[model samples]
Target: MKKWALFLLMFLLFILLACNDEETNEHVSSDQEEHEKPEVRTTPSESSKPKTKPLPEMTWEHLVNQEEGKLTANLDVDEKMSDQLVETLEKEITALTDETNDPEQIYRGAVDLLASSYYQTYFEKASTYDPDFEEPYLPDPEIEKKEGKKASPKKAFILLDASSSMLLRVNGKIKMDIAKNAVQRFGEVIGQDSDLSLLVYGHLGSESSEDKQLSCEGIEEVYEMSPYDEETFQASLNSFESKGWTPLAGAIKEAANMSRDFTEDVTVYVVSDGVETCGGDPVAAAEAFTKDSKERKVHIIGFHVDETAENELKKVSDAGNGTYYPADNEEELQDTIQKRWLPSLADLAWAHTKAPGPWEVLGKLEELEKHTNKLTEVRQLETERLNTVYRLIRDHDLLSSEAREDLKALLDERDDEIRTLIKNLTDEKKEDINKQADDIKNRVSEWRDRMYELRDEERDHS
Candidate 1:
């Protein structure tokens, strides 16, 4: 019985100790939940990197207007480095040929030199800024500019020199008659819906010394600036006779004066038979006429002009950014007007995009074409350098014959990648330009429509 009681006492003590141990474990677990943590393995991609090292990143500053803040960028391109390019290309090719005869290595090394990034120190994007290759100092393609919103209209201006030279006969008809006929036909086509004007100079006084001052000063606008009307235009053409001194420069100056205020483009056609007889700088006048306007052309047609006259007229045309056509006879004059001049005028009017004015109509297109030139140059230069390296390896008998084919295939692959890049970039530029153009057009159309409605409302009130 004593043994049994001892056993029960021991068992109760053990049970109490077990309960204390369980409570202690529960307390430790609660503390652990409050303060302590468990460890876990993490992947490199999922973890945060150390800030000590930074990766290279590209910068972009989109175009900003009044709403968005402006941002500036470096406009100047690096100095030309063709010499450096040649030298470096040679060095790289030589190194590749000497170090390894593998055509793949040589090709890749050559390609690295041709990369756009590699040329950051040489040319910037300015190397391909101008498609014509004449204007090299143009602004960089990355220039930030607001979307253009100016509308362009096509207008035609005919400058008829009615000096006594027009009195001279050609073939069976008078030169004046031929010129008048051509002008009438041109009006029929160009003035179908477009604005047209006819200005006659040197038609009041005789083409003599005594009347030189009067003839030079006498300038008449036979037809006012408006759409062509057959009856009115014919009457205006017959308003004056051909008898006066040639005031070519004065006529150009006056035309320019008339065109200065017009937001629309004025294409001028000058019909003359001689140089400036009144001692005026026709060249300077032509230059100024085209300088301040949107897109003015001064096409000069010479009628039986001497070499000196042709030369002078050619200069004037060149200054005006136009072509000079020399017609020796009546048939030649008519043919020039019918075939070359008239067709060109109609085409010009047709080809002219009726959109917002002067935001570089061919901006992205020009850049795109120019970029191809640069890429072509890059490809040529890369291939040339690689070929040199390949030849060296071939001469030294260092590489297998199969290396040639392998290098060629690699070059082709690189070129394919470049082509893909060009396509993608082109698509992006085209989409952006088209969107901007469309936006401007729609906005302008709405504004003009609203303006017309308001004007009509005012008229009704009146």
Candidate 2:
């Protein structure tokens, strides 16, 4: 019985040893599995990571819409945003160029972009000034006619600058030649019955400091203040050469002296290529000249002058309470003379009513007329730009089929916009002009009645 009990204890001890070895093997296997695995470490899932949103695809339509929004905004005249707007356009154009290697497409895009910028600038410039549309006071119409002769004939003094700058070539033609031709045309238009005079400066000497003295003293009334004579005017125009320093102030001073003696109203048209070169104060001279004479005005014409020169020249006109017209070429010069200068002459003539009140009213009407003319000229320029764009697209192979179609559509829209703006401006100007004309008519009728009352008062006193 003792041997059998010892055998059972030995068997249980063996079983216990086997169980311990198995447990040790399981621990080793677990360590090996951990080492063989990917360290049992955690990593972000694909769904857990942040994703980038794609950019919206750029297109021509999108760019057009953006520009349209910018242009349609109520912008001030002095807003300095053209540069930024141009930059945005350039970026869009660059993107378009990257997608298409077509030169035609690129060219059309560039031109259209340029046109858009130009029109915006022009529109802002035009809106800078408000038109003067106030009506003047009127007198009574039922008075008897005054027992006096009609008012003296109106006079126009053409102050032609024969400075050396006028000798410069514009459009392959001499500036002086263009100026002389314009003056001749003006003489013809004014006719023999009109009182026209020519006062030329810088016509006596060559362009030199030695000649400066003679040039400064060179102002000569070539044609006296008399009825227009074709032969006399032609001879006067032929008498001078474009030479020497500008004596603009001296010429104006001389003109003021001449105007002081005249019974009728005087309009001085100073056609110059530059400002006062002889150390003269033209603005002061102009102001002094127009101070006492209610009917006297000084108008300036800048022939082919740069911006600096234009600003300087504008001061003379501003001081004189007159308008400044800039001419860059022969065509522009002619337009300035005919549209601006000649019309002013006509208005002055009309203002020569015997009554003072009617004359003042007539002056206001003349101002309105000049403003309307300027707006008309701007509209014509826009029309020309529109026509030029159309011509380029229709007559040239400067655009691909797809580009041409898109550009045409865009231009058509632009054309419509410009046309609408021009029409609106025109209608407004016309309405103002009509109102001015009606006011003038009423004033003239009232002036006649006032004259009758004055004559009756005089007879009763006598």
Candidate 3:
């Protein structure tokens, strides 16, 4: 009777040990079910339920100009960077989880690691990176706006709305102060050979009905219509404050009047935080500016605006045959001013230079393609780094066979995601490049026709 009892006790103990060793795995949703919440994981075995530490952080930054769209990545596997990736992964396994460790937990972490917000940082900064690196960056290579030494550089007539709304603080700084910095920085850039004229509206009176007439009629060229002079521009920027109502229509009309006599093409940039509170038709005024001067282009930057104000600003830009840029911060504001088409065609001496516009534009496109090529290297490098870390862990038997396989799958999945992002972004940028190229081609064609007409008239008169 005693021996039978002992045998039964040993059998029960054996069953208990077996049950404890049966590890449960965590399940992550595949691509098709990505949006759905991850299903609850089975109860992990005592040996598999290890304490997890937070994952390592990864970031991508611009190694070049945003217009170049170049991103930095370590393809050859930097030991320091890889080491951080490994330590985070190591915490997910337990003392008893050796060669028999299941893959589910490690995989879930891998999915989170790939979806890290750091990956999206590139896009955030890329917005200011020159989304519409328009006609000025490289210019329409064929048309020349600067014809002689006496000819002035293309004019950049910048309009500022000094309505009381601009006094609102953002990130601890007043919006007017921020705009001042952006405008000054924009004026400081040389070699573009563009003269900058600073204009401000609604800077004269308070936002009271008694002062409404004063504010609405207030439009002043604080910075004279001259080449960018840092000291003078600074003084001009200091001359205004966020004091009154928004006279958007009056501002546009004033800009048109200022540039009416400019023989070369002109670009007008209006920076405002609100719409036309003065009850004027801003869109029509912009349209008239473009109509009166064929070479004039109008652009608007909505600074810290709501949806309604943005919509109205868009209409103004559209009517003026220009684009609308929204800037919530100083960096974006500066980028909006500096990054649109550089002094390309306007700076090119027109005295003896002319080329087929489309070909020149295509040539510039190649430079962009070369810049984008750097993205392909990101996939190859990240995959290699993951494989290296995996092999190191596998050879040392850090995780069970199943976990190793799952990690490999996770690595592959992450690599695919990075590739897809690169492809999509590249395609979008290429489309934009094509559109800008078409625009340049149109401008060049128009200029050629105008020149021919002028030449024929000269001959007829002679």
Candidate 4:
């Protein structure tokens, strides 16, 4: 009986162990299947994607906001003006100012404001001035055939001033240093197909009377007129120091002589801090150069100079039939070189290929006329506004008798400034518009005659 009971217990234990082993095997198989399975990703439908909004258009107000502090800093508005009046003017004028309250920006803003306010009115008036006037259609001029070998590249003469005045500091930087940096940047950007010559003056001796003669004769063509070499140009720039009298006339004469040999157009750039200090007639020199070669233009840059010096330099540029740019800081220097000189150089280089047609010239003239008229209107409006403000202050009894007198004096000064500004704007507009119109009219007449000639030739042939 005991043996039978022990056998039953062993059978029961063996059955239980077998069942546990089977359960463990099934669990391991399930986990292995899960690990071996591949991942399946489902993409979202097209309708589920987010939409992107279009960018906002940039406006004058946007520009003002971007350069708020700098634009508003130089505004000449009086603190005693009524808050409402001030606010209105600020809103109107802020759009007219930019990051740099430079003269160029102010003039440009004034023109733009005028255009926005009075372009249509003037344009209509101009259209009625000549009802029978037909706009000209000008085709591109034919490229002149080049004989066997190609012509030499156009030449650019860069006259860098290294006078004692250039050593003075402007915005914490020496004017010479600023000029050097600007020229270096310009050199880097100028096209490789053009030849550049760098002539430096006023770098030989001290500012003493004994050294004046030596400095006056120190004009050196450090970089010869050839394909631009960055290393050589930089080395030449490093060799000079600002320590002598300005020999501007001598430099211009030498540059003009050097450019006389070139068949293509030549551009002369005189970077100076002041007029000729060595008692040379720079204006005459420029005039002679321009008269000698109609293809040559001399641009003068007054670097950190006073009004008197600026006016003196302007004479040289005017005589040379070129633009006079005044640069008070590094920013202005860069702007003048990049926007004015560089583009002019490019145009001269590609004149035969890309000169504006009669149609383009005519369109530009029309635009200039519209701008001029608008500027006139703007000046008138501004004057009226100023007078209204003055009257309002007086009528409101905004100050005591003594204070009123002082305010009146201030207003009178402001009025004088406005009148001067208006006069300048008017003169500039008249000169620019009249010159552009004359040029366009001549070109249009020539184009029309050419068209008629071509039509006659075709008819004869047919």
Candidate 5:
């Protein structure tokens, strides 16, 4: 009986030892899996840290002067500058995470690694790898097309609203004061050849018609209003004052007329934060100024505007074929106007959309027909598009041959105008005119299918 008990104890000890060995093996396997890397990955050298050469340096003046459509590396010293910035941020992140290791630092180091990898790829893709580079990194080309036309440069007339509303505080500062600060930065963007005229409204009221007429050109002590010297433009921004009701519509119209002597590509920038208090339609005024057929497009910027007046400002901008930018407060307003408008104006200047008017020389009535032809083609396309919808709804049997004949005649007349214009255009203008003709052709093709459907529906009902 004693020998049998001893045998049982030995057997139990063996089972316990086997079980513990299995659990130990499992733990070791799990740890090994955690550290395993992809088959292709190799350990990097300690001394060989990923590196990227610095980007091309750009001065503030040079950067602002670059063509508007071109990508600009503006002085954006924000959260994404470099590895150092990432490193600092990582320390903060690690503190927030409560990790034993500095996870924030690790994250920043990873970001730096990514940026360096991209930079190396860019260099390799540019085929600029150094002779000593054993494993050169190359990035794919980002933008392929380089043939895009640049916008033309031009003189600018900036009109700022300095009415009572402009004095209303927003983002802890008055609106007019913010606008003035933005205007002061204009000196940095304006090219040597570009002339800038600053105009403000609602500073003073005049009962005299003469004063009112001059008010648009009113020099309320040009104390830095007109940039006589660089110093004046800078100092003037600090002294801008806001008072009274804004005669917005009149101010726009008058400013447009006064700045007529500027380059044909003149840009009129209207900065305001409210609806027109004076009795004039801002949209109508914008439309009229742009209607000259040779005038520059008017752009409107709404800064820190209330809900009451947002739509009105947008209307004025759209009517002028200009972009409307909304800036919530001072800093953003300054950045938006400078970073967006200045570049846009530069592009507009390069576009030279305002070719010297054909009417100026009074060369030939035939030449005038060329402009008329483009207008005709556009109208024909519009008419055909509209007719397609109209014909679908109408009873075909109700339509007479006379109505169809009248429409066909009108279309023929439009074609005749295009043909006549084509004979007179210079080769360059001919291509543009031809493109318009082609657009009309496409519209007509679409209308033909619609017309057939209308006829079939009419027949089925009959």
Candidate 6:
């Protein structure tokens, strides 16, 4: 019995020993498996890489240079993250390029971008404001060479009628307010080369002083055409409010001094709702003004006016040797002024009427008119085509598969009509352009003849 007990104890001890050994080996293997792969200590300096190229210093010349490589460099922006930044950069560049001659303005404009939406977020997070954050200035673009160099700055009188009629509401805002907004928008589009004057009529009360009345007349106490700076112009626009009658003729006559400046062509833009309150023929006044000087041309735009007003406005345009624009609404008014008037005026300014310069001012005017006609025709065709498609699509019944197919056929037909219209319009424009080219050639020949005649006269005098 003693031998049996001793043997059993020895067997149990051996089994326990084997089990303990196995547990120790398993723990060691598990630990080895957990730490077998290499440990990675990723520091930010190694992981967050820097860009290969440094950001370029913003300069006017660098930004505006149309050269492919230079443009690419200036435009090589991180489009995904920096659309606003890109816009800001472009605006700064344009503003700088435009106002290069004004050193103080250039300085202000350069830093203005830092205050823009793009940079504001970064700036707000900054601990301090840097007073010395000035961008390096660059010289202007080489003034483009021309046959006749004329850089005349034009003065334009914008006589906006802020009458009671304009006070009527449209599109969730008063018409006068909308007009005010539109004018403000136009101010933004106007070139640095021109000076603009803001005069609002019908805002004066009945018992107002002579000074106030004169101020509104485009003459009397007139706010003369001056440089387009934000503060003064914006103040004038903001202060304008509707009050009195539409004195259309008196306004034109008041601006007649503008006609006297033969050196610079004066343009008058009369923005009105088109009812003559103190009835004197505005057209007659315009005719008289043009006849007297033959230098000034007045443009009349009827802003959301009645049919009678439009007809009268057209007459005034004819009398003034100008174009009548019926800006039926705010959007049309905006488009008319920016896309047509401002650019035309800017080009005229480059003619420099100050001296007997060789700039083809008349030719430019004609070209502008032609461009307007072409654009108008194109727009009309496009609008007509769109309307036709819209009508067809909206009215077409598609209950059955056959009806659906029929509607599709109609859409195809409209598409064909649109294509035909486009082709016809394009061809017409081409022919018109060719005719204009021939006319220009003739005019050049005539001008050459006149020049030769003058030379002959000079020779005889000598």
Maximum-lDDT candidate: 3
Model 6 lDDT on a 0 to 1 scale: 0.54
- Residue pairs clashing, model 4: none
Candidate 2 versus truth, CA RMSD in Å, comes to 17.5
Query: Which 10-residue span in candidate 1 carries the lowest summed lDDT?
Result: 63-72
Error of 1 at 325 (Å): 1.4
- Candidate 2, run of 10 with poorest lDDT: 136-145
- Model 5: residues >4 Å from true position, as ranges? 1-152, 191-193, 205-228, 238-240, 339-462
TM-scores of all predicted structures? 0.41, 0.41, 0.42, 0.41, 0.38, 0.39
Off by over 4 Å in 6: 1-153, 206-223, 258-262, 293-295, 339-462
lDDT of each: 0.65, 0.65, 0.66, 0.65, 0.51, 0.54
- Model 2: per-residue Cα lDDT over 66-126, one tens digit each: 3422331433322333555545654555565555434435444444443332334443434
Expressed as tens digits, the lDDT of each residue in 61-172 for candidate 6 is 2222313222222322222214554454454455554433222232333333321121222222221211221111111112222224233237667778865677787676
lDDT per residue as tens, model 4, 156-231: 8889999998899988878898899788756654534468999999999989999999999999999888787879
Per-residue CA lDDT of model 1 for 1-462, tens digit only, reads 999999999999999999999999999999988786776755345245333323112121110111110110111222233565556555656666667555656665554444333223222353323222111111111111122312212677889989998888877678888788777765655675468889989897787799899999987778889987989998888788899899999999888888778887788889899989898899999998888753788889998788998999999999998879899986577555532111233333433243434556466566665654554454444445445545555666555689766876766665565455445555665566566666655654554454455556657989
Q: List all candidate RMSDs to the true structure.
A: 24.3, 17.5, 19.0, 31.2, 31.4, 25.5
For residue 298, model 5's alpha carbon misses the true position, in angstroms, by 1.2
True-vs-predicted CA distance for residue 184, candidate 3, Å: 0.8
Give the per-residue lDDT of model 5 (tens digit) for 7-104. Answer: 99999999999999999999999999888945774445746645545432323223223232111122121113345543443443334323312222
Number of colliding residue pairs in each model: 2, 4, 6, 0, 11, 3
